[model samples]
Target: MELSNSTLSSVAGLQVVVCVVFTLIFLVGMLGNSLVIWIILCNIKQQFSTVMLILNLAVADFTVLITLPFWIYSFADGWVFGAPFCNVLLYVVHCSMYASVFFITAMSIERFVAVLYPFAIQKWWRRGTIGKLTIGIWVSAFLFAVPVIDQKATHVEHPQCSLLLSSYRQQKGLIVLETLVGFVIPFLVLSICYALVAKRILKMTLQSKSKSMKVIRSVVIAFAVCWLLYHIINLLTVSSILTKTSSPEVSKMLLNISERVENLAGALAVTNSCINPILYAFAARRFQNGFNTSGIAKLFQQLNISIAEKFSNESNIRRDNFQTSV
Candidate 1:
């Protein structure tokens, strides 16, 4: 579809605004998620299946945030980076996206299992098993993104780098693959797990209704909202690609709108990183207390105390020497 100069300018302006919003969201998400990881690893002593899932989710978010500057630079100046860097960046971004979705799905399943079969959890869901599963998820995500790495680069006409699937055939293939692998499969898994979790929670006795259930519900709702937004944007993008003979002006306008929607959804997805920490703070009493009396603060306190004690010890030694000599 052909776009007029004015329409192109408008699209560029919209892209810039979206990029700025994404940058801010990425920065806030990185800081909040990093702190969550620190609190979990350094301060929290007790680890459960939920904590394991959260740790992996934080790692996935961190990986995406680490690559945000590369994308921000590309968006600002067009993709000045060569084909190789573009390929790597696209690969990493997709890897993180898939990893985040997989981790959330896994968390939902874990919650379902814990709720449905609480007695068997200690026997079946040990830390070692979780570690192995986490490694497998990372590996699978990296492999799934391989095609994206191969297909993405800076286009000859458009200065920006993007997936090289502009043709009808290529775009259809990508859309099908992305819909099935990226969204449909994960969404199905999460939905099933959530349904079971909800069923089990509903069956619980009134006395069994607890803070943990509330926390799980919040996380599940947040994850569902994020993915639902992403899925809607993806569907619109697919529709734009499939419809032929559409008016150039209309198509361009639709494309612009889709781009903005996709960007906003992406930002919302990243917000999950920050929201997890808040969920922990509100739902987990132990986490709240641990954050308050964290080892990070304790480390600084210990250093000061040690320095004062050393100085006092040296003074006492000098005083004793002086008294003996006198």
Candidate 2:
């Protein structure tokens, strides 16, 4: 009886912790993303491909975060919301998640190209290519998220909003699919693009030793850190489904541990939505400082300037230096 009481108490404690963490995330994400949108729209009078991507990302992050209140209540109490509503909520979340990932990847690739082939990016901008790309991104995000509508929260004694796939095979498939599309593919793209950007910055002597590299590393590392645990735990679940254990007790034990950690892992993943605003601020601090010093007008002028033009001039300088050295 004492052990039973203690077990219940521990479970209650964990539930409280989950609720608290999620609540904070919801508050912070909404505010931060709102500020990002406002700055892009009102403060920064000039729009560019990079700014457009940032604006879309902020919108995506904010849209998904709006669902957090419902989720938090689901966690704190239970999933009182009907099954139909659950599906709708999941669809929106999935759509926003896909959009957020794509935009971040798009931004990274854009930056990479700006450093290597600045003129091409400029020509595309003149031709309004970025606007078309943005439309395509949203369409793709919505289409990719359709499958998630079938997700129904697990119905139990408490009716908690736990996303349990319909079948064991389905579970594995969804986990693999989401991990690949959502994190792995994007992670690889971000890593490669940023690494190249860092290298170019070094070659051009753009920023002093290691500064650009550090920011590049942080961007990749932050992306990895946010989603890596969730994927690992999910992959483990897939492995467990495939591998049979001799001891039922051991299997049950492993299952229990994964169950507890998986929720926390999921929370960590949601955190990525909120954390991007912070990373963006840090990454653009130099530009932001200029805007700050010169006020709103300065920001407007600076943001209006084509990033590709600056890189083009820098590349020309490097070309000149190389020729002179020869």
Candidate 3:
């Protein structure tokens, strides 16, 4: 049932390479996320619900990005931080991850409402509403991350940090809860919202629809690519552990594979943290156009103007034209 000598060697080799790759990811992610936060903060005019959500997303991403060095060190040198610090760091990372998902989901919902129910969206655009939603998202994310606090640093065959479960039953239960709440539910809600948005877009005349909608799609796609495999690997790895009592040999083999896959998946997950800034830069016309004269600063200032006011103004102009025709 033991992992073969060759398998152990390969796992070690993969770990070394993954550590180097993750080190690069950490560097890039930190720079990208910091720039995002800086850009948003400078834009005093970027005060709408969308901007608020994005600002919070950048903050969440930055929180997680700072944790990458710890992971990089762990992957390269093993977990030397002991149990308490490991649990604390794990909690922070998970909380940030959950917050990132919630904020992205909020953005998706906002875009959906803005496109399909523009009139009603005005009522929801109040600072009070957005502020409450922001607080709720962070609070919920923190609550969901409580399970990660149970993870412990272990020195079995090698020093590493992992879930502190005493049996496969506990690990299985925890991973299932995490997979459902952390991945499945949010993704489903986002998919439905985006699907409705896309349907409405299709009904509009090609010339009337703006390319800004593409930004939503790109962000959702980035999230999926980054986190889906990692969740799937965790699920399978946990299931393999459940069977380890009957087949320790097979379980050990699968565990080794999972470790390798997790490394790759973990890197991709953090890589997602840096991608939103690039997508926003390319997809949002206003953001792109304002880049020269401290674009973000101008954008933050623009946020002070409610999106509802813009829509109302446009409606008034149209009404005036109709009145003239009469």
| Candidate whose TM-score is highest | 2
lDDT of each: 0.67, 0.74, 0.74
Cα lDDT, model 1, residue 228: 72
For candidate 1, write residues 170-208 as lDDT tens digits: 666766776678778877887787776776667554322
Better structure of 1 and 2 per lDDT: 2
lDDT of 3 by residue, 1-326 (tens): 26698888887798788778877777767776677677666645446777788889989988998887877777777888777777788789889999999999888888787777766667776537888899999999999888667544222223456556666676788788778877898899999998787777786543223444565678889999899998988877886887798888888887888876776787788888888876665554465574343654443344334355446655786899999999
Off by over 4 Å in 1: 1-16, 151-159, 203-209, 245-256, 284-326
Residue 56's lDDT in candidate 3: 94
* Alpha carbon RMSD to native, model 1: 14.5
User: Please, what are the lDDT tens digits per residue for candidate 2 over residues 88-198?
Assistant: 887888899889888878878877776678777888889999999999999999998877766443333354645666677777777788889988999889888977776
Model 1 steric clash pairs: none
Model 1: ten consecutive residues of lowest lDDT: 299-308
Itemize residue pairs with steric clashes in candidate 2. Answer: none
TM-scores, each model vs. reference:
0.74, 0.84, 0.82
Cα shift from native, residue 59, model 1 (Å): 0.2
Misplaced by over 4 Å in model 3 are 1-13, 151-157, 204-209, 242-256, 284-310, 313-326
| Candidate topping lDDT | 3
